[model samples]
Target: MAETLSNLFQQFLLYMQSGGFVMWPLLVLTIILWYAIGYRFHTLKRGSKKSVRVLIRKYLTGKRQKTKGLIDRAIVDAIEAVNGKCDGKRGREIIEDLFFPYYQDLKRYRKVISTIVMVAPLIGLLGTVIGMIETFDSLASMALFTQGGGIAAGISQALFTTQLGLVVAVPGLIMGRMLDNKANMMELELEQIKDILCAEKGLDNEI
Candidate 1:
């Protein structure tokens, strides 16, 4: 088993080396994208809950000891405001001020994912162009069809880099889009929280 794995690793290195310098950047991008995806998934999953609306409603009424998330904390703040005990805002307004920006903070890494998606394909194209130039240079002396070295290596590098780039990009794009959708869904839920709280406290009048 160890030997088999070692052989596979060696083969992977050979392929990367063949793909030339572009492979390094592509690999780096792939790593960064995957890391971002993992972080997004972890954060969203940890933060998500079922029947959050109900939990929020209960908290707003009187059960306000345990704060589950931003919504609950907002509820606590809102209650303080209604009693005129808070710093100067209603409970709902307190929730709104903190949560509105908190949502924006949640969306931070998403743009990075988007940027990587747009850049990967261009990097692949760059690799393809370099490979083509190398191949053409080999063809200058009618050696492209005859030479087994530069001409063949250039074409191989071209194909390998292009393929690697697409391979890196496709999954990153898909994952980025999926994470974006999740973020949107979370925003919608947060909006509902705001609406419910505001209705309970007449927050527009408070502010």
Candidate 2:
């Protein structure tokens, strides 16, 4: 395992060297993109197979069992807000207020993930262009013919950035889309929670 890891690290270093300066920015973008993706994934996780109404019903019955996921926590909090000492606010307003943070959490890092996904491919293309320019410049100076593999190596190295950029982008794009969909679904579920809780007189009524 140690040997395999060392070999992988060596290959990664070589990949960075072959891609030139653009690889650095791509690497940073990859880190930020995945971080944002992971955060959004954690934030949007439902942590339960139960439906929104079922979870709400459970909370309404004062079942204070352990909570999981955004909705679960929000449901528990909303129930507390409604059942707690009245503070001159309607149950609906209180529930909405309680759910506001979860709403923001759902939206967080979404734009950052999307921006990285879109920019990664463009950055890769820039690297490719830069590489091609360098390759041609070397050729112009008769430096290409003196190299072991000459033009082929230059071209290969030039394309590496493009490949890296695409590698960074495609997965981010797919995961970002999935996260966005999950966020939307969670948003709707939050709204439903608000509605279901608000419709109950004291949250003691059945859904």
Candidate 3:
């Protein structure tokens, strides 16, 4: 498997080299974008397992007779202790205050991902233009006016850059989109819990 992987990487390098200098930077950017996407995905996945629900339940159901203990537990549990206690508005307000920063961070992650997605194609196009220019220049210099040939080589380089760009963008875009959706879902869940808490406190009529 290692040998096969190494061979594949060697082949990819050869292909990239064949595409010419314009493709090099675009390829590098794609690699960086992929790394960022993978990093964020893994980090979020790990954090998601913190069991926010269980902590909330424990805090809510714990004995309230000990006033000091109750407050201490509430403080300790913080967002994790979200029991359905406040009115809808108050609950949402509390939750919003607590999670706004986190939600914004998640949003920022998606923005970075999307920026890479958009930039990759444009970079590829630049590479294509560069490749075409080089090809034309080569033909002019070589005095190949009779054949109307040797055009394919340049075109192949152009296509190669575009193909690599899309290959990088597609998966990054898909994963970024999925990540956004998951973040939204998590936000909504937080909101829903807040709503439930607020309803318990008679704050939100809808709740």
- Clashes per candidate, residues 3 or more apart or on different chains: 2, 0, 3
Off by over 4 Å in 2: 1-5, 87-89, 145-153, 202-207
**What are the per-residue Cα lDDT tens digits for candidate 2 across 1-207?**
999999999999987887778889999999999999989987887867899899878777767777777788888887777778434346676677777889899999999998998999999899888778777867877786534335555676579889988999999999999999989998999999877776764442323
> Which 10-residue span in candidate 2 carries the lowest summed lDDT?
198-207
TM-score, candidate 3, is 0.66
Best by TM-score: 2
Q: What is the TM-score of each candidate against the true structure?
A: 0.79, 0.87, 0.66
Model number with the top lDDT: 2
In candidate 1 the C-alpha lDDT for residue 133 amounts to 84
Deviation from native of the Cα of residue 126 in model 1, angstroms: 0.4
Clashing pairs in 3: 86-198, 87-198, 88-198
- Model 3, 82-178: lDDT tens digits are 4444444465566556655555655555777888899888888877886687678767787433232346657777888888778878888898888
Colliding residue pairs in candidate 2: none
Each candidate: RMSD: 3.7, 3.7, 7.3
Predictions ranked by lDDT, top down?
2, 1, 3
After TM-score superposition, the amount by which residue 110's alpha carbon in candidate 3 deviates from its true location, in angstroms, is 0.9
